[model samples]
Target: MLVWERPEPRNRPVPAPLSRDRIVRAAIRLADADGLDAVSLRKVATALDVRPMRLYGYIDSKEELLDLMVDAAYAEILPVGDDWREVLRSLAESVRHTAHEHEWLADLLGGRPQLGPHALASGERVMAALGELGVDAVMPVTAAVNAYVIGAVRREIAERRAERTTGMDEKRWQASLGPYLRRTIATGRFPALATVVRDAAHLDADDTFRIGLDFLLDGIGARVSK
Candidate 1:
């Protein structure tokens, strides 16, 4: 009897090759490239060279994928340390950077009180920093910090949306504003507004962010302290 050599077993296929982490990362990259509206299970699966059903093995739906993506993005926010003031300052700046880098992130983080795990973890870090400042009640400090971050992010998003809709570059905007603004300034009806406009020809986003951060921090330091 001729012994027939059995064919070598085909390498076991990687079952459910799509993973939660991989899916989230792909979705994030897709969002980064094409904006958040571009993120979908089908899009991610296509990007990963797999069927959309395969994504279900790891993520239940696009909503879950969004939650995961948000958590992953929030992870970039570094934890706070011993110095409460410094920690607050650093955290605020880090958030500003994150918001600017991921313009869609602010819209993803809406007014919902229930935060994703990563966001909650960042909140805890902020709370821990507040604790170091001897804050007895958790609510007030948490409320303050949350309000500050949300407000700043909202403002940034609004400005970005305005820029997108207007289609005018900053230089064009300034040049157009020059003549009209001068006329507006000459009229005494808007004295306060004119003064601010004259003082700052063009409002810079970074300067606005810094000013808002400082104002919020000052308020928190003065009011939250024992």
Candidate 2:
């Protein structure tokens, strides 16, 4: 007897050529265009002209994609010289610049342990620089530096986002609160805050970021020199 007709081929569409790099780049682009919230698998797949299921072939979950994205950002930060202070400053500035370019990056910093290859390499650079300084408890030193960078960048990003949302810069935002602030100051409940706010020269975003970074480095220097 003649062989039965071949069973109907499955109707599944051919998945588009996909790789982890492509998927992560698409996700990063989505996040860069619109904040991190916009980077879901479905949205990324649509952006890449593939089925959402296709992404699972390369990435296990959104969290893994995010980790890769953060690692990609870290990859941009090349290490500097062997001098501990200089190395740390360069690293911090590199991170700040990266955060500025990819606003979503600030959100991911310190959100989880960065165990990715690039992330680990960046961290190793920091530790190696600190190790040269003969710092006691290198882990704490690493934590402190990381905390400073994360906090500084988070504040910077938050302020920029606030300005975007309100259509106002910090000066204007503070002016908007002028009347209430004046009233509160007159009450003498927070004399020091009033004095500083009234008398202090308002630092621009870049200046504020640099000054804070220097202050953090100063603290670390003090510990190292002791």
The candidate scoring highest on TM-score is: 2
lDDT of every model, 2 decimals? 0.73, 0.83
lDDT of 2 by residue, 1-226 (tens): 1011123223345556677778889999999999999999999999999889877766678888898899999999866975877887888889999999999999888887877789889988888877866767578877777788889899889989998998999679778999998999999999999889889998887788788878888887887777
Residue 173 accuracy (lDDT) in model 2 = 78
- Candidate 2 lDDT for residue 120: 80
Residue pairs clashing, model 1: none
TM-score of 1: 0.82
Candidate 1, residue 162: Cα displacement in angstroms equals 4.2
- Poorly placed runs, candidate 2 (over 4 Å): 1-15
Among all candidates shown, the one with the greatest lDDT: 2
Tens-digit lDDT string for candidate 1 (53-82)? 777656666776777777788888876666
lDDT value, candidate 1, whole model = 0.73
What ranges in model 1 sit over 4 Å off? 1-12, 113-117, 133-136, 161-167, 200-203
